[model samples]
Target: MTWNWDQPDWPKFSYKSEALVPLEQQFLLQSGEFVGACKHMGADDQETLKIELISEEAVKTSEIEGKLLNRDSVQSSLRHQLGLGAERPGIDPAERGISEMMVDLYRNFGDSLDDATMFTWHRMLLSGDREIGAIGGYRTHAEPMQVVSGPDYKRSVHFEAPPASRMNDEMTRFIAWFNDTSPGGKTPLPPLTRAGIAHLYFVCIHPFEDGNGRIGRALAEKSLAQNLNRPSLIALAYTIERKRKDYYAALERNNKELEITAWLTYFASTILEAQRNTIARVDFFVAKAKFYETFRDQLNGRQEKVIARMFKEGIDGFKGGLSADNYITIGKTSRATATRDLQDLVEKGALTRTGELRHTRYHLSLAIQSTA
Candidate 1:
């Protein structure tokens, strides 16, 4: 079967966006609320949120590609890149590379898409990947670039990209199309529609020797940021990673044709969910700040340290709740001190305890107030 790129009118993507109007409206409204919430947050909290979102995207994007990244290392790298602080030394090259790419994307979201920018991102993506034949350039291999799965003897090809020979011309048109469809371009499209199409179009081309999925998602983020006139701060890759099987199926289904209404609808829903998750995260941070303010004078250094460690788990607290051992480990205190601190926290309404003795688990007691 011929791929979408093999069609006569290859790059002319079509979709019925009338049904997506409500989702687009909801996304815009939520985005405004998100921005408003961010503005009200203290400078420190805003910086923390920025780092958190970027770190999450870097980790999740890599996860979607079956690569696991250390979240803490990614955050440290991001801090270094954003000039918030010095990054931890000896970071894995993959983490550093993606963090650099994320920071660049965040800083230059409004810039026009070009070959140089794409190449720079490619170089950053495959910074230490030694297996690839081409690092910062388009694929030039003689064999067809195919997405496949299963054993080699009975491999199933999901999709096949254009030949290496067509890379230059195909990418030239793609860059022009991406730039021209921007908010300030000659033929601007709606935000979600543009972002969705940019992702599908780029991946169909599959211009890179590797890392195309990650880069395609970045393009989608860039498209949304340009349309919004600011950094989107949406956890797009995080959302996509959660339903990755569905994500691949959607892409595979639309690969044989140009019309992508189903893909657009799916992407729009994902964007909305991402916006909601972000809004929740903002609320979580705000609530955390309030919690600290209320208990600032009542808690000692060890209590504060342990609670902060729990907060690091984000909106969802510890998986099985923070055990006494967890408190001892994170707070670096003895059993007696840990017990006293735990009792004190419960008395001060900072923690809620459940079960009995060894079975007991401690949970933070903060309610995330709506930021919208």
Candidate 2:
């Protein structure tokens, strides 16, 4: 017999609870850290802080964007969360993989991403593996569902299975309810808060055999962008990855309990923590730009143009970092010329290239002092 989690029907999750105190404290501490990082630092050019900000910026954007999927992207996402560097994949496939999917989904619907889109994103995350789900095109599965804690590790926990042949119907109903019931399903809860809940709920549904976790997170991002009314931003997969074990436990707690008060509260709090971090990252870049601008008179024409493009596009253009193509476009020069200009900037400490060849992307080099 299966050992199910506790499900108490006594109290419905609302506003008040001593359970939320720890969450509040946790969020408060995170908010303070965010403020400290963004607010006036003694050293105007805090290179270490700036790098942390850069990595964070990338991580948050990816998370919000719902673009991260796969081992490399997952690792990169975790790396960003852990504040660790080195020992990583060459590139973040999530950005390249999921950003377009998200942007297009928002554009088509004219307001928020729909449930179908969420399922499609799930399919995409699984790279169109038909066996993953029946009707494999965003429709929920047509058969009994299976759960797995780990792919290779068969000994891992498997649970939260939905009844046979009803996964699709029940989930469809839930999606409809979620979209229509809210005062502003897209905006009722804060984006990060909403993200936490969505992630948990989708996982609870357990619609697919493989890629459920990744897809559930993706759905969280799509809803999050809609909720925040900012579809262009990246996902906070990094934040989730940082607290992987905690995140899993939170989910476990959420699934076990019938009432969502504690689950929602904790989820909302983590989201707030993630939110503070993301906003602070934006502030950090603005601060970095301002500090770097003090020596603006030293910059040449092309350098100025690159900076202008950067200012115009903000970080999404290359906040996770810019690409050789982005440099080519931003510099408005030929490939060879763009290459040279990028090289010049690299030497001048304006940019740093990560990965090799076509995988190359140039990002603000926070480490090196900018040359006039």
Candidate 3:
């Protein structure tokens, strides 16, 4: 029945320095490259990229916990927070709440970690969920909390957090380590490695009745942002979502041991992969700049919007190229208008058409090959 926190050496988490060195180097290199790439972007483009990255993180982090949020709603909320635009429809209280938390974390990345901050984040995360009842700070109930899978008849517990009675004390210790910047303190740990440890520690603490996973992930991101001294361009949540099986397995495997070398290795590797994925986005930004310069005046507003979205989102933005239906949706034009606009793009050499008649799809022409 003993969990990781029950170990005699609990809270003294350690990792293999040799294993983490290369991973750490790769992460720092990729992160620096992303930052350098971002520096070349204009202010507006930088803001757009920020919105895209944060929105993806917000949506994917919730998705990991089986909560599917509307990406548009989340994006709209974020845009409103960043003062980029007015709020859009479909932004429920939950969406707004998540947006506020995300924006706060990014904007105040260097704020000292404290109990008040943690409680505020928890309250915001569950603000309008009546079923979850009052967001009365952390869980104080003595009931056991376990992360389980499957039906009750055949449920399996993947991890068990420390008892509720131990949460406050545990968190105090964690916050001290988090805020300590002295060289002799926890600063010897690489920033990214420290971030990984913070993630595992917070999740193990499981302080809240709900939303612990999301909050933990946010804390991890905050750690990275504070360390990097900038808003994060890399979204580790996206990589975790893509490799969810390994993500959960890493957690479960480490939950049973005091030494967290495996978890640290997995965490570093995931971050490195996330940063590598972001490099493609950096290239896309460069490509987009060239694309706009070459064809900005050739396309109408609708075509410009669609092409910009395709360029920013890359391959995952649309599958099999842009279709009339998708164009209609994204461009907010009638079917006939969308078709006409698409045809105009084709004629202008901004798009290339495939298939025949109703089956046709439009892809960016040689003038702008998609980098996503």
Clash totals, every prediction: 0, 14, 0
TM-scores for all candidates?
0.93, 0.53, 0.86
Candidates 2 and 3 compared by lDDT, better number? 3
Error of 2 at 172 (Å): 1.9
Question: Model 2: per-residue lDDT, tens digit, 56-121?
Answer: 434443444343434345434444443455435554444423433443443443344455666566
lDDT scores of the candidates, listed in order: 0.92, 0.53, 0.80
Evaluated at residue 251, the lDDT of candidate 3 is 91
Please provide, for model 3 over 1-372, each residue's C-alpha lDDT reduced to its tens digit, 9 standing for 90 to 100: 678888898888877778888887877787778877778788888878778788888888888988888888999999999888899976788788888899999888788888888888877778888876438477877778899989999998888888888888998988898887422355646767888899999899898899998998898888777777776667688889988998998998898777888888888888777777676666665666776788867888888788878875553556777778889888999998987888778887777899987788887654322232
Clashing pairs in 1: none
Tell me the deviation in Å of residue 355 in model 2: 30
lDDT of 3: 0.80
Across residues 268-292, which tens digit of lDDT does each residue of candidate 1 receive?
Answer: 9999888888888888888888898
Candidate 3 residue spans exceeding 4 A from truth: 133-136, 181-186, 300-315, 323-349, 352-362, 365-372
Worst 10 residues of 1 by lDDT: 363-372
Ten contiguous residues minimizing lDDT sum, candidate 3: 363-372
- What value does the lDDT take at residue 308 in candidate 1? 86
Residue 162 Cα positional deviation in candidate 3, in Å, after optimal superposition:
1.2
* Total clashing pairs in model 1: 0
State the displacement of the C-alpha of residue 47, model 3, in Å, after optimal TM-score superposition.
1.9
